[model samples]
Target: MTCLPKCAVLELTYQCNHKCKFCSCPWYAPNSSYSIGQELNLNQWKQVILKLYDLGIQAFSISGGECLLKDCLPDILRFINEEGQTRGLRKEIVVISNGLLMNDDYLQLFKQNHVHLSMSLPGIETFAQHTGVDNANGVLHWFQEAKRIGLNTTVNITVTKKNYYELFRTISLGLINGASSVLLNRFLPGGRGLIYQDELALNKAQLNCMLDTAEEVLILSNRYGFVGTEIPLCAIDSPEKHKHLRYGTKCAAAKDFFVIDPAGQIRTCNHSPKVVGNIFHQEIIEDKEYWNIFANSNYHPTICQSCKLLNMCDCGCREVANILHHSPSAVDDSTELYVARPAKP
Candidate 1:
C-alpha cells in the first residue's frame, strides 16, 4: 500500500461560544447523543496522534465549536511537537479557532509549537450577525496579533446568502490583516444550516457570481503576493482554475484525512456519520472495510468523467454525494444531480 500524507482534523470540542445561524451540529436532534461540551482528554489525544503518525499521517488540524475552549490545547500542542520529533514526523499542526479565545500567551504557545492558526471570519458585519456578536473587530484584532507574533495565519470565510456580497471585501480584509491564505466555504445544508437553507444557501447562478468575484480576487492576491485558498468543492465557475488549484493532492477526505470525534469514533471526513474504526482501541489502517469504502467512493461528478478536467475537479465532495444521492458510488457519467453539462462536441 502506498503511504500518503494524511491530514487529520481533531474536533476538540463541539461547544462554541458563538451560535451561528448556519451551525451544522445536530444539537437539537431528540435522539442525538452528541454534545458540544464533549472533548477527548490529553492522554487520549496523544494516543490518537501517535497512531496516526505510525499510519503515515503527517499533518493535522485541530478544530472544534472552538478549539481554544479545551483549555488544554496548549499542552496538546507541546505533546504533539515532542512526540512528532521522536517519530521523525514533520507534522504541520494547525489550530482552527473562532479567534475569540486567543490571547498573547496562546499566540506564543502556537509559535513555540510551530502551529498554524486558521480563524473563522464569515464576513465583517454579516458574520457578526450570524455569530450573534455585535462586531467582528475583535476577531480582526486577533488576526493582526497572530501575524505580528510570526504565526502562520489563515482566514476561513463560510460564504452564505446573507454575506455573499461581502466576499470580495472579506478577501481584501484577510490580505490587509496579513493572513497567508483565505478559504471560502459554502454552507452545507445540514444541522442548523438546514433550517436556514433558503436564506443561507445560494442557487447555481449566485454560486457562479461568487466564483467570478473570487477569480478577480485571486488575480489581485497574486499581484499583491497574497495566497488565496478558495474551497474547490464549492467553486461553481472556472473549472480550469479549479484544476490548476488541485496540482497534485487529491481531496483531503479521500483517505488522505481523518476526523476523530469526541467519543473516539473515527471517520474519513467530518460530514461522514459512518465510523471507520476507533482510535481508542483499533488501528483504522488495518481495517479492510475502511480502505474499501475509501477506495470505492468516487467524488467526481458524473459529468467530470468525460470532462477534460476530471483530474483537477475530483467531482466535488464525497459527503455531498452520499447525503444527496444516497449512495457511495463514484459519480461517473450516470449521476446527473450535481454534474455540470459538458460542452457539446
Candidate 2:
C-alpha cells in the first residue's frame, strides 16, 4: 500500500464577494458570508504552513470565498516560499479565485511568488446569473490579463443542467483566454445548489450525455493545443469516450492535497467537512492519531471491490458517495455502471 504524499490547501477567508447559488461553503453557514469562528491570524497561518512542510507536505493551494479577500495573502505566500527554500524543499503554490478582485498589482505579486492561478468562470450569461455577478465580461478580462503576465492559468467551470449546453463554448473560452487547462465539475448537491437541485441537477441519462459532450470537447480542445482535464468522476462516467484519459493515478486529494478552512481546520478535501484535525491546535501529519482517521475511512468502494478498475477509479469522491447513499459507508453504483474498457495502447 503506497501512502500518498500530501498537499496543503489554505483558506484565507470564507468571505466571498459574489454569491453563487451553487456554492457549498455559503450554504454551510447561511445568513453570513464569513464563518462564525475567528479567522486565523498571520502567525497562526505561518505555523500551519510550516508544520505541514515539516510533516513532508510540499505543494499547496490557497482558496476561499475568494482568497484575495485576505489582505495578508501576499505575505502568506512570501512566508511559505521563504520557509520552503530554507528547508531545501521545493513547493508548488496555487490559488483558486473568481477573478473578480485581482488586478495588475496582484498579478505581479503572484508572478513574483511563482503562484499558479485557477480562475472560475461558470459559463456565459447563464453562469453569470447563477453566481449573481453582473459582469461576466469583467471576469474574462482579468483571466486574459493573468495569462498575459506569464502566470500559469487553469479555468474551473461547474457543469449543471442550466449551462450543460454551453459546455463546449466554455471550453473554447478558456482556451482562447490562455487557460492551460480546464476543470469540468458536476454540480454537487449541497449549499446554494440544493435549492436549484431540480433545475440544475442532471438525471442519469442527462449526466451521461454531458460526460460524452465533455469528452468530445476535450478532444477538440487538445487538437487545437489546449490541455483539457475533466473531473475524475465525470470522466469516469463516460469511460469509452474518455478512454484516452489515464486512470489508476492516485487522486490529487488523496495524494499531495489537503484543504484547511479559514479557522485552520484541515480535511482531506474541500467537499468533506470531516475535520481530521486543526493546524492551529495540532500537527495533523505527525500525530499518528489524526492520520489514523483517514486509515479507518476506507477508500475502496464495496461495488468497486471486484471491479478491475477499482484502484483506478477509487470509487469517486467520498463526499459524492455519501451524498448518493446518505451514509459515509455506502458505496455509489454510478461508477460501476459507467466503467468501460481502457483505451488501447
Q: In candidate 1, which residue pairs clash?
A: 15-36, 300-315, 301-315, 302-332
* CA shift of 344, model 2, Å: 18
> Can you write out model 2's per-residue Cα lDDT over 85-172, one digit (the tens) per residue?
8988665688889888878998898888878888887887686677887756766777789888888887777767788788778777
- Once fitted onto the true fold, the runs of candidate 2 whose alpha carbons sit more than 4 angstroms away are 1-4, 26-36, 223-238, 243-255, 283-301, 323-326, 333-345
**Quality of model 1 by C-alpha lDDT:** 0.66
| Per-model CA lDDT versus the true structure | 0.66, 0.66
User: Who wins the TM-score comparison?
Assistant: 1
Off by over 4 Å in 1: 1-5, 26-38, 223-237, 240-250, 283-291, 299-309, 330-339, 343-345
Q: Model 2 Cα displacement at 30 (Å)?
A: 6.4
- Which tens-of-lDDT digit does each residue in 106-195 have in candidate 1? 989988998988888888869777787654777778888888988888787777888879888887787687787766666665456656
Backbone clashes in model 2, listed as residue pairs: 5-256, 6-256, 7-256, 7-257, 248-312
lDDT of 2: 0.66
